[model samples]
Target: MSVWRRYLVKDVTGRLVDLPSRLFDSADDGTAPLPHFAGRCVELVAAVIVGDRVSHGRVTELAFTKLYFDQLGYVDAAKRERMIRLMLESCADRRCGSHRQDSHRQGDCSRLAHRAGAARDQLSREFGWEPKPDERDAALSRLDPARLRAAHREPAQTLH
Candidate 1:
């Protein structure tokens, strides 16, 4: 019996690009680049979370964790833990600068927070990778209410 799977990736332009199953088959046989395929998977998840919008770095980290969880079979426990640490560190780093603030709106933060929470829950439940209290707090803090309010208030300045 043959099992078939279909994959879709979101391009930088936000278009949903369907990846051919043959690409996976080729990668399995060493005829295609695994890194490229993995990069596409990351891009796919990132696109789902942020669409065409420019996202905060933490948003991308959450998306990466989501992708990793979705394809747990491909990742070992050690690597998964490392990725989790990297995600938390990236999220906890507060020097995100003005680009992050300029890019995200309130709705974007809500979506990112929702997805990050889901990823955290799945990590704890399935992988036995419980995040530290500070890490958890840092992840949640990425969805700053002040930043959301600032983004919300920006439109008012243009309302003249």
Candidate 2:
């Protein structure tokens, strides 16, 4: 695995507090890099929360956690709802490719299952409503990664 991957998987300290400095240090002209490192910080934070071994930084803060989840496509109220619905469906006894792999490899299932449940709870708390059955079905039907990606690209207005 590459250094970034290793760092992500093994480094318990999620302290990238100096990420700004690290990213800016390489810029001789003082201009921030494209795709801004600050923007990527959110992704890293999400990755850490999703099981990457990053532990130094605090991820529980409302602003930072919200930013990270937003960048990961969980901030849009609709998307978040859809994600939770999909998770609930996946949690059902039905079998599928992803579920099969997860069953064969418990580690993946544990991480994914934990993350899904957590995301669902987080959405429920934010939205203040229990998930409806139709919403659950819609979420399950859209669980395929390709379909989800396409939905994300659609210009549909987000609830958030």
Candidate 3:
């Protein structure tokens, strides 16, 4: 039998949601698992904010617990820090979209920004990860919606 334990996060309606067990799988060389877990956490937070799926506060709480307290064996300090950075970037992206020129999407994006910011702050506080001065500015610039849109206008590059 596998030694890994299943993890759950509570939704907005107070229902328990299962997180994939693969997220907790350790690397074969005894290294901590990679940043997929962090990406998954960002996806969950985005679902709650953009898709209106769950309780943002509760989900973030459990996310922090999973990343910091619960899965320390599978995720090391570096991984946890990377996860926190991912959450921060998501927040910055949502916030930037709020300032877009499209008025129709502005209101929705503003609401999403607020929700994402709350989740981001909660995770930062809980995980004790803070972006450096340069990183704070870099995160915003990197996720700027206008820049993202311009980049997507180019032809898609195919991977070999």
Global lDDT scores for all candidate models = 0.40, 0.34, 0.41
Best by TM-score: 3
Model 3 Cα RMSD, 1 decimal: 17.4
Model 3 CA deviation exceeding 4 Å by range: 1-100, 129-160
Q: Which candidate is the best by lDDT?
A: 3
Residue 31 in candidate 3, Cα distance off native in Å: 4.5
Q: Which digits, one per residue and each the tens of the lDDT, describe model 2 over residues 1-160?
A: 1112111110124322323323423331334342332223232211111222343221121111222223322223344466467557446432223434634566655666666667667654443422243432233232222333455678632221
Which parts of model 1 are misplaced by more than 4 Å? Answer: 1-3, 28-31, 34-160
Model 2: lowest-lDDT 10 consecutive positions: 1-10
The order by descending TM-score is: 3, 1, 2
Over the stretch 35-153, how does candidate 3's per-residue lDDT look in tens digits?
A: 43333322121111121223211111112243432243344556567666757655664445424377757766777677777767766555442334333223223223233344358
lDDT of 2: 0.34
State which candidate, 1 or 2, has the greater lDDT.
1
- Cα lDDT tens digits, model 1, 35-86, are 5434333332211122222333212222212233123223233545765764
User: What TM-score, over all chains together, does every model reach?
Assistant: 0.26, 0.21, 0.28
Error of 1 at 62 (Å): 19
Say which prediction, candidate 1 or candidate 2, comes out ahead on TM-score.
Answer: 1
Q: After superposition, how far is residue 156 of candidate 2 from its true place, in Å?
A: 34
